[model samples]
Target: MVEFAICLPFVITVTMAGAELANYTTTKMRISQLALLVADNASRIGSGSMNAKTISETQINDLLTGAGLQSGRLNLFQNGRVILASLQPSATENKFVVKWQRCRGMQQVTSSYYTATNTTNLNLPVTGDIDGITVKNHLVTPPSKGAVMFVEISYTYQPLVSLQFLPSINQTINDSAALTVRDNRDYTGGTSGIYNAENATRSLCAQYTAT
Candidate 1:
């Protein structure tokens, strides 16, 4: 009976450590996948048209809402942040700019890359190189006259079981993904017509909300 009592604490600690490790790995993967999903979907937005496609505020809201729903039990919007940006090159093609950007989530964070309508150039190379894997490297080179849909996701890890005896393992998770526009998009007006609708809510980066 004494041996059993002594061994119980150790066994419990081991089990908790194992579970925490698993949860951490899964959260990392989910954040990565979420980045990819949002970037891909952003590139595919707007109605299919041979000439060019335009996105509205309503569509952007829907995209963000979809991300929140897909987060499932993670409660992503409530605890994390999502920033979406449309990266386009300058008329000279020598510099890249953030033509437009949108954000959602209650987390108090902003994009590390660029801000909306910023004339600042991106650090990426102007030459075309899309074979890179990491988020920063993926867009090492830019496409001519085309834009890239970039997404950044930041999530705070929530441990399933707190182990007072063990060292704290909490961490802030981050992942990013980018995809070139799949079709021609209309960027002439920037975000001028996005909120043309009477009831569309703009997901401004300055504000944070789960909704």
Candidate 2:
């Protein structure tokens, strides 16, 4: 009986640890799927004209809302730098860059009013806290006479759970994705202009949002 008692705690601990690890793993996979879904949807919206004076936040919101995600949960980042919370754009030429930010909510919770429950909402405390995530897109703008337009997408992923347990759990997580873009048409001559535009966009949109 003493031997059984000694081993029982160990067994329970190991089982609970495994359960935690599994839950974390499932969350990681769901995040990946979310990233891919957002990126794919954003790319479909295409790049609106940089010179066009009237850009609609409603349209952008509609895009996200249509995808069945809350508009409050989506953030638009341009280049690698600018956080275009609304899809309003300033005049530019040749390249359009953007990323999406999302946050993971609490998986389980305990509160003073109630005990821990599985039916609790799994949304983060803050809405737009995409501290770590992947955002990717490809944009094809109207082919200019001598230059082509391109779209760039980037992502930064921070684990919702602590990094200390990631390796032991066999999960690989990152806080960010390298900036990447795809252009449908090739350009020459005024290529420098396009490159300069892209650089500016990237510089403005490259920070992570924890909230």
Candidate 3:
């Protein structure tokens, strides 16, 4: 009976620890896939237009909403953050900069690349980098005059087991993905003027909300 008492606690701790590890791994994978999905979808957004494709504030918000829905029970918007940037080449500067940026989720985290001043073209640019940003050890360079849709997602791990059993496992998980824009887009003024109506609200980087 004494042996059983001592061994039972150890077995339970081991089992719970394993569950926590599994949860962390799954969350990490989900974050990675989410980053890829956002990048891919953002790249395809401006296609199918006869005129120069333009991205709007409403459209970017919709993309963020879609990501929140895809997160399911992960509560990603509540406990995590997503930053999407349009990396473009500055012809005169001979360097790449973040032309525009949008963000969502309640987490108080910003992009690793540059601070976003606005969701539109007037945002502060990141100069001096030939390639816009690095993701998974590779530089995501904008294609010629076109732009690259870059996404970064960060999530705080939610453990399935008690913290007492897995204090170290509950850390932040981060992943990023980038893809060149599929068609010619108006990377000039961002969501200004005709692209975004007067009443539309942009998903500006400063705001932190789940919606």
- Who wins the lDDT comparison? 3
Q: What ranges in model 3 sit over 4 Å off?
A: 115-131, 189-194
Q: Write the per-residue lDDT of candidate 3 for residues 73-177, one digit (tens) a residue.
A: 899889899998878887656577776677888888988766554443444553434445776677777877788888999898777866667776548888898
Which runs of model 1 end up more than 4 angstroms from their true locations? Answer: 115-141, 163-170, 190-199
Which predicted model would earn the best TM-score? 3
Least well predicted 10-residue stretch by lDDT in candidate 2: 78-87
Candidate 3 lDDT for residue 9: 86
* Over 4 Å off, model 2: 46-55, 63-211
Candidate 1 collision pairs: none
TM-score, cand. 2? 0.36
Please, what is the whole-model Cα lDDT of each candidate in the order they appear?
0.73, 0.30, 0.77
lDDT of 1 at 2: 100
Q: Residue 126 of candidate 2: its Cα lDDT?
A: 13
Model 3 lDDT at residue 1: 95
